[model samples]
Target: MTSVYPYLPEMIASFGVERKDVAKWAGATSAVFSVAQSLTAVPWGRASDKFGRKPIIMTGLFCTMCFFLAWGVSTSLKMAIIIRALQGACNGNVGIIRTMVAEMVQERELQPKAFSIMPLVWSVGSVFGPAFGGLFAKPAERFPGLFGNSYFFNKYPFALPNIIGGVVFLISLSTAMLFLKETLHSKRHSRDWGLILGRRITEAFKDRPFRRQQKLRRYSIQDAEASAPLLQTDGTSRPAKAGREKPVAPSMSSVFTRQTVISLVSYTFLALHSVAFDQVLPVFLNYPPQEHTPRNTSLPFFFSGGFGLNSGHIGTIFTFYGITSGVIQFVLFPPLCARFGVLRCFRVCVLVFPVIYFLLPFTVLVENATTRYAALLVLMICKAFAVIIGFPCSTILLTNSAASLSILGTLNGFATTFSALGRASGPALAGLAFTWGVKNNMIGAPWWILGFIAAVGSLPVWMIVEGEGPTAGSSDSSDAESTDAEEEAVVFDDDDDLLDNLTTARRGSGREQQGLLKKGSEDTRNTGYGTVR
Candidate 1:
């Protein structure tokens, strides 16, 4: 997916197509692709929630394989565009995959490791996808009989790679179908598309109160011990029959609190800047006609050859940045959050990123090749560090806020929707910004503008409270200590009374009372507040 555009020039030239026409086709196709892909996530997620994960995932993969095959066999540019749009619509696995991983992994501590592994796989895919595309995207003399006399082979030099991609997609689809187990526990599947889509949209808007009510009825009976059977006492008594009725626990509707909305907007802004810079930085750094030569010509060759960052050494450098950021997020950010708290960690990152952005322009001033490379490396490392600091903190803030709203999945969808919006627009915005800057002879202007934007974005985060010191509802400082002591005293008193009651019931031979106590403990455990000690 990442390398699709890299073959645009070759595609235009080989097909004898106008650059403008090709650009328009690509732009419209990509826009439709993005919209369809982004909008499909929630409904797919909802479908997985109802129809079982394996079936939904297998269906998606099968559709994806068909789309890839269509793309591989495309003869005309219009056909290619249609195939890509269908490909986007069918490839709604992002949200489903995340949900599956979450369901499969029980421990939160292991989540970062699982998430990290996916990106590593994707990075490998990204590197090889382009490398293989470039290798296979040559004239038919290179591989004469492989795709002999096919329209795709004649019109599109890159047809081989697409064909291979289609094969891979089919293999993946088959593998998933054979191995993947159902994760969703729902007894009833939602066959109605209208109802499914409506529910998804409603959930996105935090309107799950009616669903909660339906669930609550089932839980209310369970909570009231309606499942327990009545016992009859005759000579050699037997247990009585159970009630047919069960109380349902009411489902609570999630409210979009102000704090959650603010966090979402803030994250959207940050993502806009990050995605824009990610898309544009390589283009800016690798602009044609290299003005500066390295002191050691072998350095670029060595690194580029090893990493396969063919956009000069810049791509390799960015990969390093990505690797560093991922490592830090998995290793460092969690501990920092545990110590200083999520909000404090978030503010610190917000404060630091602007400083890194401000320093980026200085790379242009270093005249010595070694020094310049060193500076660029340091700048990239700092940017990576800022990302490490920012991303997890932002996630923590958003998740915590969502928890308060009691709608974690819907809130996450809202955040993702906005992030997708930013990603969709970021490249165009950067292109315009860069063109304007260059036209105005402001070679160094982008950095300052980025710095100012980052700083402004940070301001909203600071307005939100850092979770430390003597803030209300916090378990920090002497007040919290005193509160903890009181809580402990109450807990001890309750335990003592429970023990007394148990002892009295034993002495009185009242088994029903003991049974009630056991039921109460079980209920407490289910509520997630059970104390081990």
Candidate 2:
């Protein structure tokens, strides 16, 4: 996604789009990808549910790598859109990644920090992503010293960035394939050919005898114990049972309970406005430099041209935003969520967005270069902080709202669909608004409109009721019905605990099958809920 951002306008313009229509087409390209994402996120999510998390993740990385390379050499707008749509359709790892994280960090106390990891990684990527998109873009011109005479860089000005992206994806795919363990409890012990083959090759190279190697293995005894029949509480050994009943996927009606619906709706609105702002930033930066008028009292009703930065400069500014945001997220988000509560912090963050949008257009109004840049920096910092807080909070809330782990993939899939629709609409509408505004001499129209949308988005947070974990009791019947008895929760820091627990999953161990430790759920509920006022 970051591979195309910095020079999106130039990229679109190269495809024969009129200068006036480049932004519109750029928005269309992004919207089309999200539209495709909306169509397939559910299926990909369900695939993760049915197959396993690791495989699905690997699949997304591979497909994205291939399609991103296709994106680099696009000859036309339609071709670009087609490649982007294909990319979105083939990749659905986002929700699955969240599901896997939530399962791995089942302890609610750790959720704030745990959930922050994904967005934190995104922030780190944002730092490098735009750098890749910008500095490597049109390298023949940007770095005439090195690539001025090179044929490949000269012929395909934009391909280098995406080539870099594809390499990054390849490395990630290899890493996941070799080391990422499945988090799904049902599939924990399931055979993984990639891991199995990798292990066999490593084992084959060992100089020690097989008997000595087996004796030295730490898990060998544990695996043997797990394979034997589980001992009952009364010291009697129960026969090993066949595959335990797979928990049925909850019906859609059941999954979308009041709290869950609220979470999804709020997330949709959050994605809508947030993505619009993100989409607008690049175009806003790449615009031709215009002299700022001294008549700044017109407020948001009147606005003129942008900072007119080149892709390299834009990349540097974005890198600053990303680095600072990542630091703030890493340093502050967890403690704030822990102290003030996740939902409360999230609600406040959402409320601040409208004001941020209202103030955004003013950045272009300052005529003095030094003052203007300082103001822009402050605003960017504020935006970075709010976004860092808001996103992880949303993830934690939505994750806890799942009816059961058995239904988490489907629920997340459905939620992703809502988010995708919001993302799809954001750019399309913002693009149209931007075009109209630019033509009509109301340059802030899109920003102001998004501000209004942000205000409306804030309304859903008021209606959002936090989802509770299993030990969390409520007088509300809705929450009671949300629980599923058969989906026993087990808190393991890693997959190595699988063998020890497998010995406890016997016919006579129904009571032992309940969540091994239920403290995390209650702690999560208490810490994550609070009044914003």
User: Which candidate number maximizes TM-score?
Assistant: 2
Worst 10-residue stretch by lDDT in candidate 2?
524-533
By TM-score, how accurate is candidate 2? Answer: 0.83
Model 1, span 1-533: residue lDDT tens: 44233443344334555522333333344445545666776566556554556677788877877776666556666776677667766765554664455445434454345444454454455455545555565436456776556666776666676677777777776566444444432211213333334334544566467566333222221211112222122112122212111112112334255666677667766766665555556545543322334431222111110111223255345555555655665577567666766678777877776777666645654557678678877877776666556654665455545332113334454566665555445444554555554444344444556666778888789766432111122111234246435443212122234345435544654777566545435533343111211
The lDDT per prediction is: 0.50, 0.73
lDDT of 2: 0.73
* Tens-digit per-residue lDDT, 1-533, candidate 2: 44238878889888888866766887888888888888999998888877788888888889888999988888888899999898878765578988878767767889999999988988988898888898899989989999999998888889999998888888898878766778764465454666655545666676676635333232221221112233233223344334331434557876778888888888898888788778877887777766646553354476567788888888888888899989998999989999998889999999888998888877887778899888888888888888888888988888787757767778788878888888889888888888877776667777888889989988988887667742232122233233212122222322234333433443334664433222222222332111100
Give the range of the ten consecutive residues with the poorest summed lDDT in model 1.
299-308
Task: Return the TM-score for each candidate structure.
Answer: 0.57, 0.83
